[model samples]
Target: MTNPDKTGLKPTCREAHRLVSEGMDRELSFVERTRLRLHLMVCDGCTRFNGQMALLRTAMRRFPDEHGK
Candidate 1:
């Protein structure tokens, strides 16, 4: 999708979330990471959401063996 920012930048929250969530395991193009970072900069809600997601990921990793998965 041709996402754009307030200043006509090539970035948006939807693209950022996808990169942060799915692109982490694979190689993220520089543009994707840049877009994610840009979205995190001016958007506190998305920033906090990203932080929480990271925290949850860390917690799950730490307790992976605790759950009988």
Candidate 2:
């Protein structure tokens, strides 16, 4: 069996998950973002995962801790 990490054809799902969260936080490195984009192009599950992440971010922003207390 080929080592997926070396092949770069199958990055670990944990890496994908981390990339998704980093993308959400706008803190991903450029290469990380590019890899994530490539992965999402072929992975429906990651696409839906990103979509839900966006929704969660929007919801959190809309109901923030206003007082900072």
Candidate 3:
């Protein structure tokens, strides 16, 4: 995870996952989204991870609650 600008933004798979996870909870900043996209473009593993996370998000949204509502 190398920080190209030393601004704490790591353009690596780990960082990409972090960004993706954070994005699920809140809107990522422009720089964060850009960094994550760039990383996903070059990393198949991270790309798949990002897709999987998205799928999980969608599934969770449609899941029934414990009360079975």
- List the candidate 1 regions with Cα displacement exceeding 4 Å: 1-10, 66-69
Instruction: Provide the TM-score for each candidate, comma-separated.
Output: 0.69, 0.75, 0.81
Positional deviation of residue 49's Cα in model 3 after best superposition, in angstroms: 0.1
RMSD of 2: 2.8
lDDT of 1 at 24: 44
lDDT (10s digit) by residue, model 3, range 1-69: 855634554476667878899999999999988878778777899989999999999999899989988
Computed on alpha carbons, the lDDT of every model, listed in order, comes to 0.73, 0.78, 0.83
| Candidate 3 lDDT trough over 10 residues, lowest sum | 2-11
Positional deviation of residue 23's Cα in model 1 after best superposition, in angstroms: 3.5
| Candidate 2 residue-wise lDDT at 10 | 45
Any runs in candidate 2 off by more than 4 Å, and if so which? Answer: 6-10, 66-69
Q: Write the per-residue lDDT of candidate 1 for residues 25-63, one digit (tens) a residue.
A: 787877777777877889887788789888988897878
User: Cα deviation of 40 in candidate 3 (Å)?
Assistant: 0.9
Candidate 3: where are CA atoms >4 Å away? Answer: 1-10
After TM-score superposition, the amount by which residue 20's alpha carbon in candidate 1 deviates from its true location, in angstroms, is 1.8
